[model samples]
Target: MKTETKIMASILIFIAILLAGAVFFLSGDQKTMSQGEGNQLTYKIDYSNGQKIGSDSAKIKLVEFSDFQCPACKGFEPFLKQALTDYKNDILFVYKHFPLPQHLNAKTAANMAEYAATEGKFWQMHDKLFETQEQWSALKDPTEFFIKLGKEIGLDETKSREAIEKSLYNNLISRHKDEGINLEVSATPTVFLNGVKLKLQKFSDLTQEIQKQL
Candidate 1:
């Protein structure tokens, strides 16, 4: 009787130890998960000031920082457009200027887009700039091309030229670029979905991320 009682007591103690360890292990895992989530960087961006093309009450806000002269940005244009079209109701897409210093014409293009905005031709000029990026990228001066594009988009040639020459939207463009720099955007076409920077290899990957947010 005494031996049996001792044996039972030992068994109970071992079981208690095991239960305590299991609880600690589970709590540790939960702590680790919480820490990982907390470590994720969420940027605070002003989407209202940028060129927006979606519903204001969208659940998902996508902000794109791009350089007009960057080929990758041009390539991503179609995919971006498609995503906006497909998720128009759920997503608010904002285009922010981040013209790389290496690209002489990129800042000018961004300035032109902002100027076009004044005349209600921003989207048209934006598309035209990206569509014909290759044609004007290598020029010593792309002002002529921009003026021509302005004409095609029904912008006053003289006003467009003055905008470029006088840097009419310089402050706005500079602000956008500065904000991109502060956000650590090292490459063209850097994208953020709901303040979380995305590493997308393809357009489909972007769609997947958007769907996940939705």
Candidate 2:
């Protein structure tokens, strides 16, 4: 009888320890998010262009801070493209970066895409990066992957490589990040329609909310 009680007590103790560890891990993640200066984001003011593809003076100005390696951002792309198609004359789209550290290749991918922006291939490279995210995101050397993507998009490989190597638009990327932080972006794939936060859950939610605003 005593042995049975000891066994049950041991099992309970193990479960308690497991639960405590899980709580600790989750808390650490929250702490990391709130760790920056002022414990909040501060976006620097800059009017520099960021790979503008559509009309600059559209009625709806949408700014998105996303990571190339983020799956949620990938899922949101089709919806965004469809929005452009549906509201062609009404929206001006802007892209920015908020790369999470867990996704190792996001920063380089963002920088490379910024370089591609110089050649008018930002959107193309942006789409391609999301399309091939699973391939290069985990690799130690993303050069070949980036090169292949540039070739696929018909960009000058030499220019693309040189741009990334030189950290072309590095300052612009930094400014975008700072801007996003200042705007209270705590995660990748944050979208603002006319400077108002888009409460995202599904496609219909985006269309309905945006349509109302329009």
Candidate 3:
């Protein structure tokens, strides 16, 4: 009788262990599903002033930290642009610079972008920069190209060049970086939506997330 009881106890312990393992597996799966449903952009983030474009008041806001020379950033540009166009009334997108030191032209490009912002042409220059990335990327005279591009886009070339020289938006750029660092951004093209790091895997993923927030 005692031997029989021991055998039953052992069986029950084994069953309990199996049940616990199953629970753990299921919990992990649920967590993955939950995370997948959220913003795919993974980066630590902090905000300052919060007065920047797209930050003040919007149904949904996306903050993108990017490098001008980053291939990934370039690749993701189209999807981002589509988001802006598709959700113009529902979403506001903000750009931040996190130019990597390895890219020789990235920092300069960032500076130029900041200067463009001062001229009230940030978005226009932003589009031109990304559209003409390949042309100016390999050249040593990227500034001239940017200047010309600005003129083509109705920006005052003389004023634009002067803005770049004077670094008019230098403080704003620095503020963006400072805020990004505080937010724990360690990479380029990190995006956040409504204060959450987007978990977006593709344009579709972003669209779904935006729909939820809206």
Best by TM-score: 1
Candidate 3 local lDDT, residue 200: 65
CA lDDT, every model vs. true structure: 0.87, 0.76, 0.71
Better of 2 and 3 by lDDT: 2
Candidate 2 backbone collisions, by pair: 43-178, 43-182
**What ranking emerges by lDDT with the best candidate at the front?**
1, 2, 3
Assess the local accuracy of residue 180 in candidate 3 as a C-alpha lDDT between 0 and 100: 72
What are the C-alpha RMSDs, in order, of all predicted structures? 9.8, 10.8, 7.9
For candidate 3, the per-residue lDDT at 160 reads 70
The segments of candidate 2 whose C-alpha lies over 4 angstroms from its true place after superposition are 1-48
The per-prediction tally of clashing pairs is 0, 2, 10
Predicted structure with the largest lDDT when compared to the true one: 1
> What is the per-residue lDDT of model 2 for residues 1-214, given as tens digits with 9 covering 90 to 100?
9999999999999999999999898676553233334343223322244555467777777778898889988988888888878887787777778887788778889888987777788888998999888888789879778978999988888887876677676687777777777667888788876656666778557767568658
Show where candidate 1 strays beyond 4 Å.
Answer: 1-39
Query: TM-scores for all candidates?
Result: 0.81, 0.74, 0.68
